[model samples]
Target chain A: MTDTIAIGTADRKDAKTGTVAANRALAGPRVNGKAVVMTLYLVFLMLPIYWLVNMSLKTNTEITSGLTLWPRQITFDNYIRIFTDQSWYSGYINSLTYVVINTVLSISFALPAAYAFSRYRFLGDKHLFFWLLTNRMAPPAVFALPFFNLYSAIGLFDTPWAVALAHCLFNIPLAVWILEGFMSGVPREIDETAAIDGYSFPRFFVKIFMPLIASGIGVAAFFCFMFSWVELLLARTLTTVNAKPIAATMTRTISASGMDWGMLAAAGVLTIVPGALVIWFVRNYIAKGFALGRV
Target chain B: MTKTLNNKAWFLVLPVFAIVAFSAVLPLMTVVNYSVQDTFGNNQFFWNGIGWFQELLDPSKELGGRFFEALWRTLLFSAIILAIEIPLGILVALSMPREGWTVALCLVLMALPLLIPWNVVGTIWQVFARGDIGLLGWVVNHLGIDYNYTGDALDAWATIIVMDVWHWTSLVALLCYAGLKSIPDAYYQAARIDGASRWAVFRTIQLPKMRRVLLIAVLLRFMDSFMIYTEPFVLTGGGPGNATTFLSIDLVKLALGQFDLGKAAALSLVYNLIILAICWVFYTVMTNVDADRERVEA
Candidate 1:
């Protein structure tokens, strides 16, 4: 597990090869096997999304008349409908507003705790960390009733803040865990160095360490936003009709009138678009976030 | 210095901690309170002791109701999910290339489904499984399978299972792929010198190293699958007559749809205990296995 071949093999890829070898040469295949593998994965990954996107562009009649691999004459109607329709736009705003608020709250709370756990051994560090993770593991359905009662009694039910707060339970733990892992990689010496130079801890965290792991914090917040944005159970339970997300709106696809296939497909496509954009940018941060050091 | 928390660090994390604690503790306390109490419509509650627990656990009591049935279904669901997803994810990861933009691209694509919301996944499947109009359903039907998730139990189960596999197996593959990437060429070289077969190298070397992340993968997938609600709920509404109903769906039905708060609270507490117990056991076993691996290495 030690950092084997730390100096040579890694550098070889960057400097050597006057002839400019194939990209797959690094992994032992001449045809760039990684690209092939990645292409195959992209196909697997994009197929359903592609189907949803195609479905979204079509009219309802075209949608339910048995699936076509491609859309028959495209229409902007579904997308246009989502925007022009008051109910759809409100749900979209509801989901977006709360997701933003909750992500901010999660990172703000998690950063200090993660820094504390990473740096200082407090009175109940292990227990507190473990306790935080328990929330991460707790099923939302298990708490749905209590949340309804509690939020309703407090007059918070049906508010965006209710879902925002409920999501904070899981997202905060995740944010803390990811941030802690990132912070731990920074040596205590760095903190000592900053403070020895007369920098305050807050100043030090904000100015010194912040930039060092900006990617990590950004990564954690992206996840926070992602989870809260897509979350349905607690969000759905907490909000009745007024502040529901697009998820709840999509549920109305099923009615006595039968399924609204085109609209549902459009909604599904819209949801995936935001996530796709974030993941496209942060894909590298994700893999590095998954591991460090040698095997 | 290590002993001093300085109180100031708490300020840095206060935003997240306050939000999490507010959401977590009160609802939990409410559940605990109701698990031992009876409540009328007026919000007046009376101590019911462990009466709910006894009824929930008693086999002779059909009062076990759909709770027991949902639990059994969840167990089966979790089992099927693990069996299908783990191998499939491993294969997908193994088939992936080891380096360059290709590796990066694959990672991004694999992560796409994981990033999407769970309910949206259900919606996608819901539309996709329409025999009359959905792409998946139409294709399968074109191939001569009935495949209606809304009407048939088996089709409902199959569609949901396939949707889940499509959704989550990517996560396991990514984690495993990360694990594989971390392995230095030296160990693989040692196996090569020893002339070990690929399966032997995988089992004796790869699987052993992967044990840690594999534990994490299993625990995460199990918890998620057991707690699953939105996807199946969206797809089937726990229907074709309760075939796809799990604990979460039933809890939602009782608490929200039926407005039975007291029973919902009690049921929620039981549900939490099951997750807590399973998580504890899994964590313990994982830690012990890690310890065992350390000893063997020594």
Candidate 2:
């Protein structure tokens, strides 16, 4: 099912130059309209983020006293406090730890499965594929209490591994789905040629096949990272303090002093930084990855 | 390309199967177990045998009424967001610059919201839509509109909807953009020679090509919005008398907040089944579409 979609994207890349030229001519008259649309959309997209950033730079008094487009009396105290505070800084480390663990676990497990799905049709392959997808659709809420109980029972609760494994419920399926698409795009002839060259399956898979789908792996890992990082419910429910994610920490910003608007804004801004960095690295694959490689 | 039939392939699939099952199946079994049994304090339990389900399905009952209201509200929210985001996303994708540094710029900026933690998305909106400190709220109020999401249910709903749109429209746009990029120049050139109007070109060429991605975008947006919790939870904490309490939020409140294990489990099962049924429909449609395209190509 995914192979057809993969073929479409592989073909599209080859035909991209011609399409770009055609689009330029076709877009000539509508440039102004397109610009206006893009500007408005981008502005809408950025405004809230800009507000968060704006608030982060202001002192708590300045933030609550009035609305300002830009910080009136800029203060780095919020950022400094977060950096200095152990609880705040540890959240980032914990989030990154589990995200990395989840990404690695998901991609590694998914690679073999994706290769299997792409290369051969076995008994229940179609059923297996569909079943995997249903996991992706399972609401985290439905799993939250059960997960908390299950994880705690197994002594895996409040650890990075718990969240990493919990995330596999969705991320593994996603990785497999995406990697299968990319693998299917590579012809079976490569496998035949490698076999004829006296290469063993594992060796060829590691030495040749891995390089071929490097970007696919990257894309899959990127998604795993994104989902695991952004997800809070299971992560929060599963962990108490040690493995608490930065996102979960941000949710607990209300203090004895009341709403710490400046610190909260600063924390919010910090959370976005890691995601932005990850997105920048995967910007080229962002669109294709969003499509799950179906494009 | 035909795949060789090989049962050895199961070995390759074993790791994923083990990990996923450990995570998915075990918790699922617990949910199922809880749904069927009545629970008391100290982990003592009794067999309830569909009693909870019965109560859940009947609207006259308190649990049932809350369940149905939240369900309908969730469905409505999903519908509204999909209606707004899909067309808007397509337009943005269409309006996207063909080739330049600007394309990357737009793609990056557009995707920024998607990467933000769901809670922070709520926080950003919470701050951004506040009457006192939020730019959006202050502007709207100054424009002579009484806008306060914290107080008014309608305002809460609008804020949640708009926050959703802001957070997710980019995913749809990016998916559509990728789909649009896949259309070969030949299609557009052919349309030009045929003197196709822009709308006609979109309808005949772009829209047809985009069908697969659009299906995906719709499916994703529907599922995510239907299961929305953290954003609304942070923004209004289900807000001003349960106005924004979607199913996930309600379930969390019931399960974790109230510790109503039997009821929450039943609710969870029903909620999950609903998502599964919808997802199954989409999967069937998607596979059929793929099959039809393959047949056409052949």
Candidate 3:
């Protein structure tokens, strides 16, 4: 399927060059319109983020005093404070810890299950798959209190493990769903060939099959990381102090003195960095991943 | 693809099953337990079967009124989000550059909003839409339309809806772009040869080709919007007067704030059931659509 799309793209490139004059005449206005639409939409998307970044660079007094598109007196005090303070910087560490754990856990657990669903017809497989998907739809609000009790009773509360494990409620299902889609796209002949080659199931899976779906695994892990990092409700509820996510710690921006606009904007800006970094790593797979590999 | 029957495959699935069951089932059981029973301070409990559920469903009761109001508001919010996002997403996806370095740049920037923490998204909008300092709020006020999300219920609703659109529309667009990418140039060539109008090509070819991804996008948007909590909570704190208190906000208040476990549990169960029902419908439709497409191809 992907091969056909690649071929089609090459064909379009050839066609564009081949009929340059005629094609340009026909598509000129439409192309310009597309560029305009894209520019406007991208601007709409970036303006708010630009505002946040703008505020983060300014002093608290300047932030409250007036609106500024660009900071007149840029100061690093907010970023400096976050990096220097133990409480502030620790939140980022804590958030990264659980997000990493959850992504690893979700992808590892989902891998075998996804392979099973894709490669075999097991007892109640369809029902099981659907049931798993239903978990993705379960509201985090419904699970917050119960998770708090369950984790505390198990002595995992107020720890990164609690949030990581709790996050599995949704992330596992999602990983399995995405991985299954990617796995199903691979031909069954490969599995049969491996068997004919006298390969053990585990060896075939790890050495041969795993490499084939490496991008799928990357996509799944990316999604797992994205969800676990951004989720605040369960993360905040499960951990009060020691494992507080950067997002939860962000609430501290509301101090007794008043809202610390600069620090709040700084923390918000900082939260976007890890995500942006992750997106950069997975940029190629993102569109396909967002399709959950069904396409 | 064909699969061999192998019940033994369950072994491969056991780890996921165990972990998910531990995470999902155990907490779910706790919710069920809370739903049936009343609890006093120090966890003293009494039987309260059907009582909380009844109160939750009965509009005359205060609990029921709040639940129904939030449910309607949430449903309306989800509906409006879908109505706006799906069309806008398709437009953006259609406008995406077909090739070159800009593709990666567009995708990376488009995905940035999706990865931001929900509360940060709220904060961005909250700060961006403030009347005094927020660029959007300041600009809108400068236009001489009295716009204060902090004070006006209608403005609060609009701010939240717009914020959600900003955050999630990228997801829909990205999915649709994938769907569009999969279409072979042969289809376009054929349409061009036939001298088909752009709308004709889109209606007859692009839309049908995009059906699968669109369904996925719709299902995700609906579920996420319906369950939205952190963004609106941070942005409006459920508002000037419960104007933006969706289901999750109300549930958090009931469960955590008031410590009303029974009512919260009941609401949670009902809420889960509604989502489950909608999800089942979408799943059934998706499978049927897949089967139909397969049959047509065959």
Query: Which candidate leads the pack in TM-score?
Result: 3
Tell me the fnat of candidate 1.
Answer: 0.60
Please give each candidate's TM-score. 0.87, 0.95, 0.96
What does the lDDT read for residue A138 in candidate 3?
98
Q: Which pairs in model 2 have colliding backbones? A: none
lDDT of 1 at B228: 93
Error of 1 at A195 (Å): 2.3
Kindly report which residue stretches of model 1 are placed more than 4 angstroms away from their true locations once superposed: A1-44, A256-258, A290-295, B1-18, B189-196, B285-298
- Among these predictions, the greatest lDDT belongs to 3
lDDT tens per residue, model 3, A1-295? 5434543554476476685444443354677889999999999999999999999999999988877789999999999999999999999999999999999999999999999999899999999999899999999999999999999999999999999999999999999999999999999999989999999999999999999999999999999999998899999999989999999898887963899999999999999999999999999999999999999
- The per-model DockQ list reads 0.39, 0.47, 0.58
Worst 10 residues of 1 chain B by lDDT: B1-10
DockQ head-to-head 1 vs 2, winner: 2
> What does candidate 1's lDDT look like per residue over A89-146, in tens digits?
7988888888988999888888888888777765556666777878889998887777
Question: What is the C-alpha local distance difference test score of each model?
Answer: 0.78, 0.90, 0.93
Please give the lDDT score for candidate 1: 0.78
